[model samples]
Target: MSLDYTSHSHRPEPDELVPSRYALRIGEIDVLVISDGVLPLPTAMLAHNVDPAVRAAWLNDMFLPPDAFDWALNVVVARSGGQTILIDAGLGLDPDLNLPRAGQLVRRLEAAGIDLGSVTDVVLTHMHMDHIGGLLVDGVKDRLRPDLRIHVAAAEVEFWASPDFSHVSMPPGFPDALRSAAKRFVKEYRSQLRTFEEEHEVAPGVVVRRTGGHTPGHSVVRLASGGDRLTFAGDLVFAVGFDHPDWYNGFEHDPEESAQVRVRLLRELAANGELLVATHLPFPSIGRVALDGDVFRWVPTFWDY
Candidate 1:
């Protein structure tokens, strides 16, 4: 058979805006998946072990941009036991940060009828800027919900708050400016910060589990109520990490530890069929992990218009 090689000049202009908020019901708890925006990271920064050609081929097979990878900033908002809880604050409102595509959490929250003051708690899954940046408003931190309690992993806080942290070399491809921003956030919330070690419940039905390696104190938020369960997997698996759990990203503080945690978490989620809410997955990033042979695969939940 012969194929037509003609091209059309009537391509539509790109639409950048997408429905950024999604409401999910997990038993008695109401969860909102709020999108700050998408970030385009260089693909070369993802897997350090894979050859350039193999990595490009892998990304190409998945129909992703071979040059840059699209990472979504999905924050979680949960209402349980009369408490409004925000999982991880999105990138803060800073135009100079070169993240103009992000920092939309506040606007999106208001659009969803979420009042910042009404949020009783803000959980920092890790000390990374993208996770805690939304805690600042107008380039200053005090303008945010000052009365709300901020939950952070003790290890994460100590690492970022250390005087030596600024002098240490950041992971490959990780921006140094983010370290400065993270320090500011830590100082701003230090008064209201409640650091937790090991597993503990931060809110009514929300439990924080220490899953370090991505950072010294990286954690995941687990929500369970009325037999329904959902996990907020913070940077545990991004893009192809599910299929290749050993693939180390340049952002990990401890690549080996990160891989171990990723593999362990993926196994548990895949076995139990619990909903996995990833921060850096595609927008509205709610899904289930399925065991594909010895590895795993992401099965995004059905989208409801």
Candidate 2:
């Protein structure tokens, strides 16, 4: 459906008009950046391999709050012709997880003129809770959109769904009930979910690019229309401290791979000068990468909201 940006009625409220939720035009395609809300994590959770003093000093230099960090959860909603493609369902409500802002995904979709049920395809960058939780609704026992075509990285789904890893590598203390919910959802909806490798076109102008690191099968997405290009750099690159491109979250399955992939992707993005959607970057998470000396920086885009 063609969106009329002039219609204020469809826009989010002033309070919800975060820099993270905005629309961009790439040739004939309209890309709406939606928020799944933000996650507030303690400093300890983020201070993985870095020394505390170094981390604190870096945080101070970046002018970040000394106490904690706010990681933004952004999902891409791209509309062109009759296709309404959603990339990465946000984290849904999980009281046990103390996540209140998660379920904001669906609401943000409506604010952007996308009816959840009308979403034809959902491209999951990974199967992590934060990326797939919003695929279902709170208290709903069925697939949120029974007919929605869900595409996932074949290796990712296999790793997560494999029974062998359930008792071994799966994180301890994971909410039992939520795990059961995930298993049931996967069992019933597995038929609607398809897996792809390397490169595949989900739609006319949207393509999937597999970039593993954070997860064995994690992938990023690339959208191109005319000469304009946009890449959703999944978890390959974290927005921890925009200046600290080498910093990797402790949760990354393979920090070295994650960092390597991130650096390579950043160089390509910087060279091509394409717009990027960073899931963890400070709101609206759309930006371009630039080289500053030997390091890179995230240069946010200005959206005419």
Candidate 3:
């Protein structure tokens, strides 16, 4: 029998929902969750290392599409001690890439009443494209907040800016592009750049903790004030990683080390009741980690209208 493929008469036009933006109060600090956009990746690209059966089962159990993974690109704005700080720059204005739906960070920021010039600092959790892409305007000269102090992990800057980084095996031109971008960023914002080698306060109540593995200088940002704590976990764990902390995606520089960091950080967050703001979780990706038997589960923050 043939199936009916005609459009229904009463069907309404699809609504173009505005991007998500959320604000959270962490003690004395205020954090705004700005949505850059969503990135739809192949499920296999994320779970390539997992056994096919196990991967399929996991997707089935979660009621997720077996062939697709919808990942969120979230950037954070933290306001504390009279300082407005941006965590990671969203994908910048790159028209040639496949990320047409992405790179809405600047517009979203404006919608949220945040002026780029008013931003005092931009803390880079790592140097990945998605995390740092929003820094530049045309991929060459114009920068978003060039005068703002740009804080990055020393190790990250050293590795990505060095000749050794070109030797790292990556997609055809990934390394070269990354190197070029990093150099441009460095040169453009050199005067305002600050590199930290150890875990230290980048701003009042803001701490940068090195959690390498995903990249040479991957790190998480910790915000503390009035006994309340929230962590900006940059690419530390994605959706599937919550159930299987050891499952490594294709992007990690060192899968084993990345897994170790995930496991250790999950334990710490769960035990301490610290709030986690994952960059790649669903929109408004603020949550708490809860220990579930041998694994961990993500409990997203309750929405307050």
Best by lDDT: 1
The candidate maximizing TM-score is 1
Model 3, 1-305: lDDT tens digits are 00011111212223435546777667888888777888766676565567988988988998989887678999888887877889999877666567777888887776566777778888998887778888786632343456678888889888776635421334456566666767877787778878888786767898888888888788999999899999999888898888988887766777778889999999999999999988888887888999999999999978765
136-207, model 1: which lDDT tens digit per residue? 667435445667888888988888865233222344435656777788887777898988897878767899
- lDDT for model 2, please: 0.73
Instruction: Estimate, for each residue in 71-114, the C-alpha lDDT of model 2 and write its tens digit.
Output: 88888888766777889888877677777766688766666656
Runs of candidate 2 exceeding 4 Å displacement:
5-11, 14-20, 139-145, 162-185
- Which 10-residue window in model 1 sums to the lowest lDDT? 1-10
Q: How does each model score on lDDT?
A: 0.79, 0.73, 0.77
Candidate that beats the other on lDDT, 1 or 2, i.e. the better one: 1
| Ranked by lDDT, top first | 1, 3, 2
TM-score of each: 0.89, 0.88, 0.88
Q: Between candidates 1 and 2, name the one with more favorable TM-score.
A: 1
**True lDDT of residue 273, candidate 1:** 90
Off by over 4 Å in 3: 1-19, 139-146, 163-177
Task: Write out the backbone clash pairs for model 1.
Answer: none
